[model samples]
Target: MNYTLTPLGDRAIVIELGNEITIATHNLVQSVVAFLDQHPFDWITEYIPAFTTVTIFYNPLLVLPKTNQTTSASPYEHVVNELIPYLDNLEENHSELGRTIEIPVCYGGELGPDLPYVAEYHNLSEEQIVDLHSKGDYLVYMIGFAPGFPYIGGMPEDLATPRKDNPRLKIPAGSVGIAGNQTGVYPIETPGGWQLIGRTPLPLFDPELEPPTLLKTGDVIRFKPITKQEFDSYKEDKA
Candidate 1:
């Protein structure tokens, strides 16, 4: 329940829950988001949840008219006052548990052209790299950079590698890669600098689906290694 309120532009307020990107902070962020979702203000437009903050955007016109000090105080002040009570009362245990999703990946070869580079960088064999990556626990910290792209955390420090100096113009969807101490899958084809080590056949983003993105923040991710033949079969099954 510890936080600081800061103004964002003219009509938004940011509630910073913690200073670090730990699971405890993540839970607090989720708790705040859940509280707002269940008890939304009429003037509030939307709320964006990040690693350690929840940004609430509002309509100043609606907010200004509702405040008791309409003539004396700004909309930002009024909104912050209204939000404090609710945030203070939010229970940390109210944060929902996330789902665990298994993703099958085909490592090396054409799909993961940078696998050798990562192996060499870590001074390990390509097979050892795959084993380390596949066995590590991962969490979806946030979705950003591109639509449906998941910024994951909890990658083993042993597999850590820097991003490519020169980014690729168009990485195919489902390409899994490591950057720093994190790992993620490209939900859509886009320019990226992460060192590609594998790829999944899953269609991670689809406009036709109810939720376009396959992953959401707080979800637990498991990577399963698949053979080239198995990867082909997965695609064929989907086709």
Candidate 2:
């Protein structure tokens, strides 16, 4: 319950769980989210949790505004005052493991244009590069950049590489790329600089669905290498 609450304009309050990014901090954030999701404040509209922070979006008018206080309070202050008691008495357990998700990927060739470049840069064979990447047990730290695009961590340090010097005008949706210490799948066709390593045939984002994004914060991903024929087969099956 030791956390700092900060105002974000008129409708949002960001809960700073800790100063550093760690599993313990993320665990606390998720615990709070689980509690509030079931017993949410009537004014609250959104709950967005990241590596070590949680942002609460609420309606200003819906919360009780105090008139007797010496200083006027914004919606942020109103929420802080109302939610402080629950924050103090909660029990947060950090030992629980995240849910594991298996993702199928087709590396090299047309699916991964920069696969050779990454292998050459690392002084490793294409097979070695793929092995290093797929072997790591990656965690979904947060979902950012494009919608449903998860900013994942725990990539093998040897596979670390800087973003492209000149970013491509458009990267195909489902393109998997490594940027520094993290790796992510491009959920939609957009400009990007991450070194493209492979492509997942999985449909990551579909707005019509109840939950559009295939992944969420705290989910663990294990990449299963797939052949081009299998990737094409997946697409055909989905179609």
Candidate 3:
């Protein structure tokens, strides 16, 4: 995917990281970061990644205009030209950024009222559904919408289901769910529309923890089905 750098005034260029936020694109983001750091452009500040793009924040007041640079040569143009060559030649790197966390979840019961419905909709037994979800390796694409909310990829196509027509008032935290092509865990109890197949008792977002987010971008997540008894025990320990 190609990048388009837009000048946000004299200070910063927003690098648009197009629609490739998979493991393949992880290297692209890191390469950009490494290059930017080495170049030492005072104007560039932060590089934020979303599902499809990376927004580069910059500080213009600090970076003076080049002595020989003309008004026609914008910082965005200069940065993009310098960056593309590096990105083009660099191989896509897939570094192990985070651990594969196996989260234990309990399916069905009050915690997952829609579990049966989802299975029925897909014409599969509840056990089959659980096995499919548990077996897949999910990649954490981006963290957004809520704190520690991971937008996971790698869900089985057969298990793909639409979200609830109407969102619930209070979705308990540690909810494991799917919406369209993506699957994720709700870090905190809040309103949501994702199809709830199970609930993990793990605290996904712990403010008291050194890193509040239980997972981050580039981490791999897999759900392990456990009995309600196990779920209860884990929740109690967290408390």
Reference-based lDDT, residue 154, model 3? 87
Model 1 over residues 32-85: C-alpha lDDT tens digits?
Answer: 877887888899999878888888999988887643544787788789888888
lDDT by residue (1-239, candidate 3, tens digit) is 35666776665566666566666666456455556557665566766566655566665443436675455665556666655786576554536456799989899888778899889999999999999999978887778899999888889999889999999888888888888877888998889898998899888887888789888766788899999999988878868
Model 1 TM-score relative to the real fold: 0.93
TM-score of candidate 3 against the unseen true structure = 0.81
- Which 10 residues in a row give candidate 3 its minimum summed lDDT? 60-69
> Clash pairs of candidate 2?
none
**Residue 236's C-alpha lDDT in candidate 2?**
100
Clashes of each: 0, 0, 2
Kindly report which residue stretches of model 1 are placed more than 4 angstroms away from their true locations once superposed. 66-70, 94-96
Question: Model 3 shows how many backbone clashes?
Answer: 2
Q: Candidate 3: give the clashing pairs.
A: 11-60, 43-59
The order by descending lDDT is 1, 2, 3
**Candidate 3, residue 63: CA error in Å?**
2.9
